[model samples]
Target: MTVQLNNGFLKQQTGNTIQIDQPVKLLVVNLMPNKLETERQFVRLFSHLSLDVAVTFLRMASHHSKHIPEAKLQQTYATLTDVYDQQFDGMVVTGAPVEDIAYDAVDYWPEFNTLLNWRHDHVRQSILECWAAQAGIYVDFGINKRVIPKKLFGVYRCEIDQKTALTAGFNQLSMPQSRHATLGHINDPRLAVLASDPEAGPVILASKQTHSTYISGHPEYETNTLFNEFNRDREKGLPIQLPKNYFSKDKPTNTWQRDSIHLYDNWVHSLKKVKV
Candidate 1:
């Protein structure tokens, strides 16, 4: 991705500072068409952490963007080749809408694999969300994503499995999920389920060392994200299920969903504590 520096956002590095060469660097590979909103989500999460984090946005070169402004995409993001040699404290790969088809069908499959392989060697830790989580399972462990009979919609409760750092303080966190595809039975030996629901698929999983986080639900979603998705699909005449327990009195306009934001904060705080 292009490394265009944000002039005002960049804090000047001082030689006399206590931790002068140790600022945490995070690279966010945003696959969402709404790049600005995705950027806001990451910013909101990172801002709450105690660490000083500098984020670099990475965009896929293989796909054309329709919703994002051309100038913003060009100015903020770069192709995978642009960040190959960089070492980062953490990385986040956002979800895309390509789960219905095979990964090979997407134009950037090869590039995506390259990014994953590079992360395996270079990145200290990484988070994969939604479809990106499915992609990780497929690529790294040969696990396939199965198209569910119906879309998994709304906010669901996730009980944290305390075996890993990702759920260090999480007890029963509710997360927002807005997606059409879900992973089927995963028989991969390298993957471990971290959180699950009897009705929904496993909401969280990780590789053995907690270096990689694969979350089926979107903990980073804003309160209005589910509402926005519902409205968008409704306008487009696409089939959408009402989010479970999302609306107050079954009315979308009456209540606010505050659970996602809280859950996301917990996840970020926990991730910040992880040592490589």
Candidate 2:
């Protein structure tokens, strides 16, 4: 259950050995256009933890990806039908680029609904990120996301509920947020607000029944994610503002998000404790 690492090559952690068990099977439903980059981001965060997690990427069978090559998708990803009878300890639904559109308008909305319903029986714990968070809330609780005046594209300071297992070690957390829509008001009794920000509203929401976690911000985002998004928008002549608290001296540099890593570590621990 434990393994040692020396200081020579593995520079991320110092000390001797780390404890690990049988690798946790995680199903990742990637909705992002840039599938490979998103997968790498999640894998990078998951690798930092002591637990070994085997991730299986799931692509939408209903929606065809225009950005990623068809051959690559066929080779690397699995459809819902491929793993319909299988179950996982944890499932992650990534944020998509379809935030501007209505939930019913998206091509994969129906398929998404099917997947959400399936998770009730197939998954032990699920984490929905950004647009998928909105979708999950709307599908399960009938809470619709509202359009914001400006895109919430920046690194925000969030107040975490330290008492929650998902955020046990985090007091205040900084995460990357990039979305055009916001979960305006959630009045569901089954949902608990785990974290929030004045600018970003509800950063984290947890469901009492399904043990599902929803995150409006991208904790798995790399340091330059927001900076790259800002530049991309600017190049396209889109009205974009500088990501707050991201670049020091207004210059893009690698921002070490140690707290984000801890947040994920806590989440993986919580998943491991689940009785399934």
Task: List pairs with backbone clashes in candidate 1.
Answer: 1-78, 2-77, 2-78, 154-243
**lDDT, candidate 1, 120-154, per-residue tens:** 77787788999999898788787788788778887
**After superposition, candidate 2 runs with Cα above 4 Å error:** 1-21, 253-256
Span of 10 residues, lowest total lDDT, candidate 2:
2-11
* TM-score for candidate 1, residues paired by index: 0.83
After the best TM-score superposition of candidate 1, give how far the Cα of residue 261 lies from its true spot, in angstroms: 6.5
What lDDT, from 0 to 1, does candidate 1 have? 0.71
Model 2: per-residue lDDT, tens digit, 116-201? 99999999899999999988998888888999989887888888753688878777888889989998766778998888898899
Q: How does each model score on lDDT?
A: 0.71, 0.81
Q: Lowest-lDDT window of 10 residues in candidate 1? A: 7-16
